[model samples]
Target: MQLGCWQDCIGAIDGTHVSAWVTGPDTATYFGRKYCHTQNIMAACDFDMCFIFISCGWEGSMHDSRIFNEILINDNVTFPHPEEGKYYLVDASYPNRVGYLALFKGNRYHQQQFRRSQQNRTAKTSRELFNKVHSSLRSVVKRTFGAWKNRWGFIRDMPRYDFANVQVLLVSASMALHNYIRRNTGNPTTVHLICDEEEAMTIVNAIPEVEHDNDDLMVGDEDPQMALMRLRIRDKLVYLRNNGMLENI
Candidate 1:
């Protein structure tokens, strides 16, 4: 898959807080560790990075994974599971599951992105590799969230009514609209979401260049450090090569 995931990826999962203008007794429930009072919204995106799920109105104090488990369970959501099976990408704040890939401390995604950065302020192989791979694929989900928030700005300005109910409706409507856009527009934005095997192969064959830069990172020539960097870069390059995304150019 373009995401380097199995073809059945239902997309990445993440939560964002929509700031509210009103606060009262419920503020404590809605105010999260981030020190902000808002409604938490959990969302799912597909391969094309379109939002397929958006559950909102939960107090910000709730964990993202819990919100997902509560609202997006079977029967409630109408979307069919991917043929290979459905899975989602989530941050460390989420627990791992057969249906979800969690970015925890030991996870390749997080370790490569954060571990080395913590130990070495400058250059780290894993960091470089993570950045490279992250830039390439992770942007899809991020962009999806950005677009959703942009379209549903009302999520932030919830009226002083039953904030919870309004929040739910807003999220549901947003997702429905997102799906509508994909279906009506024929995936003009995705280019190839529901492509046939041949079409998928064609896309796979069109390898894009991997944009990597070694200049900004500081490489320390020492034991464990240099070795770590080498290992990270090696692994990352291997992945890129396997994906046929490294451009000869």
Candidate 2:
């Protein structure tokens, strides 16, 4: 968690799709990428490589920011932040919110810098070294997702359960089991989660409901407030891009 020191460390936030086998005339609803219905799961994991919170069972149709608003931000979860304040890492798809920090998108320079830092190799400067070390620490949670899906086939292919609620219970049980094994065995490398954005997007975009819609509009047009909110986020994203704080444009 120490990027030069713990002061700059924050947990990373990301989501993945968990496939589940569902039934009824709603069978089409369960068919997700590669022919499966995906449940979007989000989690926050600290620098210690431990999970702070995890939420799942969201229909694949929901956007990342909307899920964060409903499950994490509005849900009233709190975390201990460094002196600078609490922050979480998220992707470009998320909204520009107050409590979390997002990686910048659209800048090749920043992206290259980040990629080099992520490798955790020796760097010329202390700041670069810290960035690499800190990024590696946050990578544990991403690995967890990989282990969950690969080791537990139920996650890769939804298990046949009597009800969707039961399917959820099974998923939770699998996660709990994963935690138990990791804690008792003291093995951090037991699982590996795929971090490739293209792979993730393939599954996420497979959902028919999401494929058909581009915006969250209730009617033909967005409300003024909603439009403004979108504009504000866009501006903030641009600001982050202009600053070296974010790497994407």
Candidate 3:
């Protein structure tokens, strides 16, 4: 909502590869497209950059869609089921299912960040408006991940530790402490590491080297109710923009 999204936009969800040093046979399982031993850490964070949910300990080779489906089916996962009419922003890699909003398929939407030349990028249609708004709001998770990694040097140059403890201790503890600093501070952004690195830690699929998966995307069969919700949101965003209630972004 802070990014001009509707009140129903609760937060953003995405997966990141936490670099690790695993021994022996586990190296093969942990090696991903980035050519490093990483554990796929799926997390959800709100506008305040607090990780409200985290599912770690997955192999880096595992696809996000596969992990997401597994989390849904597995009764053990305490996935925070959103209240009715609320949803979390996800990327093209995730399915457009209930409680998870994604970009509108077949639309020419903006990427993670905009260039100076693309500043004039406007929504000519309702679908474009929805796409623009959704993409902007969904970027919170990327920014949160960026700040988290930047604040903790250990995540970048990880030291040797038990593979299981890497997820439970380092990953979870970092996020928990990140939340503490973020919540306790007046300006959390100011406390972010004074580094020269990029600010947005986008999903791997958004990277040029890592290719996007074709199957299980939003283009496939999705929840009928969610499809309708997307339509309504598209129309609503256009309406708000036309009346000057919403910005062209």
Top model number, TM-score: 3
Q: Estimate the TM-score of every prediction.
A: 0.60, 0.57, 0.81
Alpha carbon lDDT of residue 205, candidate 2? 39
Off by over 4 Å in 2: 5-8, 24-35, 73-84, 109-138, 188-249
- Badly placed stretches (over 4 Å) of model 1 are 1-6, 21-24, 69-86, 104-135, 185-187, 191-249
List lDDT for all candidates, in order: 0.56, 0.52, 0.73
Kindly indicate the candidate among 1 and 2 with the higher lDDT. 1
Query: Candidate 3, after superposition: displacement of residue 167 in Å?
Result: 5.3
lDDT of 1 by residue, 1-249 (tens): 333323444567777777654466777887786687777777767657677666667788888767766765757666434333455655555654555544313324532444355454322343444444433444566677777678776765666665556656766687678667767776655424444666655654454434445553333322233233333344545555556654320
**What is every candidate's alpha-carbon RMSD to the true fold?**
9.7, 13.7, 10.1
**How high is the lDDT of residue 247 in model 2?**
38
Q: Is candidate 1 or candidate 2 better by TM-score?
A: 1
Q: Worst ten-residue run, lDDT, model 2?
A: 1-10
Select the stronger candidate by TM-score from 2 and 3.
3
